[model samples]
Target: MPEIKKYLSIVALGENRDKLARDLVGAIARRGCEVNECRITPLGDHFSAAMLLAGNWSAMGKMESALPGLAEHLGLAIQFQHARPAEPQTDFRPYAAEVVAPQQPRLLGELLDFFTEQETNVVEVSSQAYDSGLTGAAMCTLHMALQVPVNHHPQTLRDAFMDVCDDLHADGLLDPIKT
Candidate 1:
């Protein structure tokens, strides 16, 4: 059986997240580690990357040492930490959702609260706020991957989320992720 080492997730942001990602991945590979997954997103003037990596425990120190130089050279901060392994809960259903609305304080907090109240487990979340250039309206958008217990019917969660969206005057959707 292969050793199950702890996973390390890195989130880096800077003027050039792509370069940072490439450099970081190269550095990790050089240290004999493998990157499992990486995703990059443009956050207005900045770029961000979320990466999942795993390898021999002994290589962690070498990788950590390389991080500072890359972070400094890239002119941004690179943060990493051990990630919790996924739960093998067959009773949980996967879901993908999004919420879009005019930018406002407390919108994100309220949505998170609803998720907590519903006993949903958030796997991944990314959000951005920007101006609708045509309308000049400030808009915020949230995308999330979730695991909802099978006991909670999809429609039930949708209805509850819709209620929150309605109250917040936002548009949202909750749909099962196709496995």
Candidate 2:
């Protein structure tokens, strides 16, 4: 019989350092775990990372045991939990959404609410805030990967999205993700 694989989901936060990613990945490797997926970003003065690790049961145990001491040594705050890989969704199609507008309170919240109301699953999201060089106005841009239900008509969804953007005074686009 094939050995069942185990998984760990970890999120770590710390002051930004040049060696943090190397140290974290090395620690996982030393414990015989493989990083399946990870996102590490420098946010302001801090560093943030989220990773999915895969291993056998024993290796998973080793990682769980070693993580705390490693976190302390690195001055990082860490949290981890057992996790399973996401199952494939056949009834949904992958799409990308982008929105750019003057930064305002509740802008992100309102966009998220639209997705929730449409029953679209947000797979990943990233946003940035900056000042427009030409206008000297605060601006924000957001990008999201979504799993949209197949039942919704694509043109209808795009139209509705545009309407929402008009109401928010934003420029937005929704298109199928190209592989």
The TM-scores of all predictions, comma-separated, are: 0.81, 0.97
- Where does model 1 exceed 4 Å of error? 1-6, 15-18, 69-76, 82-84
Q: Write the per-residue lDDT of candidate 1 for residues 32-76, one digit (tens) a residue.
A: 667877887777878777887777677766776777886787686
What do the candidate models score in CA lDDT, each in turn?
Answer: 0.83, 0.95
RMSD of 1: 2.6
Off by over 4 Å in 2: none
**How does candidate 2 score on lDDT?**
0.95
Model 1's alpha-carbon lDDT is 0.83
lDDT of 2 by residue, 1-179 (tens): 99899999999999998888999999999999999999999888999999999999999999999989999998899999999998999999999999999998888888899989999999999999999999999999999999999999999999999998998899999999988
Estimate the TM-score for candidate 1.
0.81
